[model samples]
Target: MSTFIDIHALQTLPPSNINRDDTGAPKTATFGGVPRQRVSSQAWKSSIRQDFSESLDSSQLGLRTKRVAEKVVKQIEQLSEGYDKEKALSEVAAAFKTVGISLAEPKKKKNEEEDSTLESGYLLLLSNQQINRLAQAIVEANGEKLKKADVAKILDTQHSADIALFGRMLADAPDFNVDASCQVAHALGVHESEPEFDYYTAVDDVVKEAEESGAGMIGTVEMMSSTLYRYANINLNGLVKNLDDSEAAVAVAVQFIKSFITAMPTGKQNSFANRTLPEAVVVSLRDDRPVSYVNAFETPVKESAEHGRRYEAAKALAAEAQELSETYGMEPVKSYVLAVGDLKTALEGLGEETNLKVLLESLSTDLSKVLAN
Candidate 1:
């Protein structure tokens, strides 16, 4: 039986282009024959990963970049004072070759300063522990070439929290792929939404009264305000297996819940400052399967005379979950809710209401017990 943790949030954002398309407009999708603002899963996942960097230890995180060899080279230099940049680059490149990852040849600039940094063909997601261990292996080798099996073994295990949660796919070496234990649904607005344009001009600060009569620059930016439905889930069994530690998996889950609720996409943040917390959050632990209440907004929530979109959306979500539970007997082993304002009243009976801190603490205890079983 696969244990799962499902997290749902109803958040409201002010006029902002949190995620944009090639045209620089806010992302949108048509659901129920109505256009609704959207924020891609990739965007939210990126925000969550960045949030991880702030709260989690650097050693328990991974780096995803094409400059894997360069990072390893730095690690090698740190591990052994005897190894210089040139020597470290050679050793790191040789170690990568053993794992079938050929680093790009160093390119020399016009200045004739040979760039020693080697890049991989694509971005490689490697945990900090893996980099440290690989560097230690090179230092221990003392100019001797590392074996293929040794390098592969070092890369295969010791996954960091982010890597384990989001997983990795190495195109050049599929054997090193880690299946992601978590899935995030692209957040969609709960009601029909249309893009609004902000047309404005900027004056040149250096321009004197007679120097420039017109504005230095003028442009239009597309923005949208929406109450969105967000959903994500984690396969606890898979997470535990990826981490190889039940307690650590629980800790990751707690952090993920917090991040999912609070982490906001920073697109045009300076322009809009559209950061907002979730109006309501519902978390459930299940032994059967994870359930998403996204269908609640399929009909598109409409604001009432006395209440706004956030309150209406919360009501709809609660009603949807209740209907599904009554009809299908889809009940979770444990559940919690954190809501504010009239949303607290609108989401009655969804679960036990709690604050963010208490919700995480209780979730940690419950998850440990569930995993123990």
Candidate 2:
């Protein structure tokens, strides 16, 4: 039997530039003939990966960087004491070359910072355990010749949860690519919204009024306020396969569910301080394919006389999800809902009502049962 988890959330935010476009305005997309605030899938995935560090062990996380040689050199220096910097660099370069990465020097940046380290010219997404294993292998080789097989064996992404969930693609080596198990959609506002500009000037405190008649600096920032609908689905079977069927897979799933609830993107956060929590969350465990209820807001939810925007959005989401499940004949194995304020009653009839802690506990139990079978 196949099992999948689908999550739908409603989060309200005040005016903020949490995510921006190239034009320095809040990101947006047109849906149902109206412009809606958007936060890209890449942005939220990055936030989720960062949150994993706080919730899971370091061994389960991955590192993404173009400075593979530098990262491996540090490991070599730590593992093999007294190894000269030049020797370490040479050994790591040789190891990487064996894995199909070219050692050609890259173009200098505009600022041209003095960087002596060699790079692969592309992002190398590797796991912490894979890096440590490579370091151990390099140390054991004792400056002798290394083989391609040695690099391949150590570079295998065995215990990396981020790699398993978000996936990685090594351009130089097609064999190293991993298919992502968890799929996340871009978060979009439930209603049409417009970006507004804040224009202001700053005066230097040290500059005297007599010396400086004009302001020291002036700028405009674009921001928006809206209630967002965020959705994500996890393929439990694929997650199990990615982790090599380890028992710890259940814990990984649980940690991710928790992070999805707590993590928020930090774009101009210090300037805007748009910190907020999800007002509602509805999850479903189904043997059928994952379903997203975003289409419910295609017409754009509106604030009515009796209910506010968020409350109306929750009602629309609950109603749509129920209709879709019934229409598509999706017989969910289990379902749960956690909502606040008016959402508590709005989505109550959709599933078993519970809080975050209770929901997480119940989901963990479900994952364990799947592994046992």
Number of the predicted model whose lDDT against the real structure is largest: 1
Best of the candidates, TM-score? 1
RMSD of each: 1.9, 1.9
Instruction: Report the Cα lDDT for candidate 2.
Output: 0.86
What tens digits encode model 1's per-residue C-alpha lDDT throughout 25-90?
999999988999999999999999999999999888999998888888888877777678888888
TM-score of each candidate? 0.95, 0.95
Q: What does candidate 2's lDDT look like per residue over 234-266, in tens digits?
A: 888888888886467777877888888889999
What's model 2's TM-score? 0.95
Cα lDDT, all candidates: 0.92, 0.86
What lDDT would candidate 1 get against the real structure? 0.92
